[model samples]
Target: MTDILDAAVERAGLPVHWSWRIEVRPRRRTLGLDVLPDGSIVIAVPRQTTPEDVTGVLRERRLWLAKAVRRREALAAEHPAKELVNGEGFTYLGRHYRLLLVDEQTAPVRLRGGWLRLRGDAGAADIVDWYRVRGRHWLIEKVRSWAGRVGVEPPEVLVRDLSTRWGLRTKDRSLAFHWASMQLSPDLLDLVVVHELIHLLVPRHDDEFRQRLLVALPEAVVLESKLHDEGRRVWMGAVRAAL
Candidate 1:
């Protein structure tokens, strides 16, 4: 596999300025390639496909591969630095809250007196850490409220900074949400949280699922559309934060 990758790189004559790696997956039925967030490539091929064939396919897709790799690298470069100091903002329930740095003797983030408060001078990573902790707390409370109203309760709930997708549901009734949803409005955020939790009972998106969701959220379609258009910006902003 290493020899095949080396040969492909040699044949393609790609630039060496950027870092790259390749993974060979024999389970693949055809030549396939994927670009990782760190600008590396993972190439897969069926057991029957020859190295020469893999190289040719990669060569044909070189331009696309290069563009994908560059985009991933660019997003990584845009990730934001964290701080509770002035000029930093936090996204809570789909709204942007400018971090109003205040002089406090504690080292914790709080939403007090109608402001998202981070009570220490911390870097971007710290701010994210605060969110990972406090954010889940907020999410759990909100999800419980919505679940009660919807008459559905997931067996478990999880929250994290997911790189893709708003939320997911597991077969065992575990519901997960992308922490970035905090950037959205409370109503929209609740809608998403409830939607994922309901999937614990109804695992697939079918008519019954839509019906239940509508009963749970009368404005589900409207909010879903808004998410499709504007909600993507939140993820994009998070990617830019990588810079």
Candidate 2:
């Protein structure tokens, strides 16, 4: 039987108090609510489970489920839609950059006078590519500056778009920064930098590695939370506009 059918039988018109979206897949398993990495809540039930059973479980875990959903909704609200246009501003490395439209340039994006000027013929793709290049240069500079203070220099830095991750570091001391990360706040971007640089010294995220990261960035946890809440929407919007 379908999970919905079962839930209906068990619930039998249970009073509506807590509400949640339920999903039943044809998996050979029982029911569970999974906390997705993107912060969405998923109540996964077997195809045979009825709505009543599902509702019962939901009622049992109402507080847990509600808290998770509320968090996601709040984060979604924080990443409200943005109107990308001339005079609109963005930040980089703790500085503000106003957007300007230019009609003559072949390249789609350029930075000047604390402004990120885009060619009038450009679209989101051009902007993304442009920002990626700029992000690499900016990140590299930041990394070099911070690394010098700690007496550690990475061998190389790579920049590209990556979904589901912000950055990566290899044993060879090469670093990869997500191009999509350009849309993130400077604080989070710097956290990524510190993360990869720390990897050069400690390859694993053990307690010692975490301690080292904290020494470099005391607000890493806060920045990471903000990134988790707003990063995807920011990048997704830009990518969609560019397309």
Candidate 3:
């Protein structure tokens, strides 16, 4: 199956530079193309689908695939990695703070005196825990405000590593946000909160959803574009090895 898909993609004249793979889905009914955050491409197909069909879909969406891949590549290039050293920068609620190693502290990490103070023995996990703790506290209030405006009951909010997603609305109506989102500015973070709240009333990103979102956030389009640009620079827990 893999060889067949590879042959099909090659025959379709798609760019060879792309890192791509094929996945057979037993329950899928149609072909799906996914460009992941790290610039890898996934071609999902039903078990009964032919290589010819795969080639046709690839050919049809060639331009779109190229654009998506390029965007992912650009974002990946800009993704930030931090070193756990004195004077190293970190962001919270869009404000930049320098990391300061402290000999002794009550906690593993704390943001005080405009500095992200980390215990000398601590590492990236401590910083991540700080983000999660602070993000959860901040998001809870923002979620309540947005939920009230959207006229829906506020769901339980959690701040954790969401991988490729900034926010998620689960089937149980719970909302979870990426801890990295705490690095975004307050306005942008509000956009994330409002986005999930709107999803509670409208499940899909259709015309109705857009209308509702615009009504709730007049600057939704601009903020979304900014989020895309700024989100790329957020540190997703990658750390430089100590020299």
Candidate 4:
């Protein structure tokens, strides 16, 4: 079913040696483990799978998963949590701006006096809306620019809140980007743009795909390493206090 059946699984006396939580999915052909960006693991299993099989798989991969989990935890600790309050640092286009709340402002969000100004007592919604709007606009422009360089038609940008991916390219040639991409510096963000645009030419990440990417962005490898480092700071565990 979904992640909700975890209690039943535990009650059934399955092994819980795995440090992270698991989601058992029946009616699926594959038994897979996804390490989410929020530092959680989702284990998907087929209907015919046994608790013994799942436990075996987990045990076999225990060391690798443990290392992965530690990395995720370190990243989370690096970014921590961001609270929307006066003088709190918020990023926009590689620069940090203090969030200044003003009561008399008409707009819910905007840039005023170099601060990410909010009208009144704002929560997650207002901040998310503002980031989404900016991310969408910026990514659309990047898609257009990078597509032309890649010799492909520009794809329509779809901004989304994604936990498992930074960017995705669909069969329809449209590009989907995580909204937090806006927090990245322009150079780092360009790497994501170039990556998705190249996917338009080569769907799979095979040799030819990498060759083409290098041709367009010669420093792809270095840029990728930097992106991973900077991205950790951009990815706070959760925005809302409740989350």
Cα RMSD of all models vs. native, in order, equals 7.6, 7.2, 8.5, 8.2
Best by lDDT: 3
Of the pair 1 and 3, which is ahead by lDDT? 3
Q: Which ten residues in a row have the lowest lDDT in candidate 2?
A: 234-243
lDDT of 3 at 225: 99
Give the local distance difference test score of model 2: 0.69
Give all TM-scores, in the order shown: 0.61, 0.57, 0.70, 0.68
Q: Which ranking of candidates, highest lDDT first?
A: 3, 4, 1, 2
lDDT of 4 by residue, 48-82 (tens): 77666666676676677777777876766877667
Higher-ranked by lDDT: 2 or 3: 3
Model 3 sits at a Cα RMSD from the real structure of: 8.5
| Better model by lDDT: candidate 1 vs candidate 2 | 1
Query: 1-243 in candidate 1: lDDT tens per residue?
Result: 677667866787667775556566777777778887767777766667666786788778889988998898776555443434555666666666666666683775666665767555544555556666766788888878877877775346686766777788755677777766666787788778878867866878999899999988889999888877656555333322322
> What value does the lDDT take at residue 49 in candidate 3?
88
Give lDDT: candidate 1, residue 15: 71
Q: Give the alpha carbon lDDT tens digit for every residue of 1-243 in model 3.
A: 778878988888877688888898989999999998778999999998888999999999999999999998886678866889899999999999999999999999999999999999899988999999989999999999888888899899988999989999987999999999999999999889989998888899999999988999999999999999899899999776668
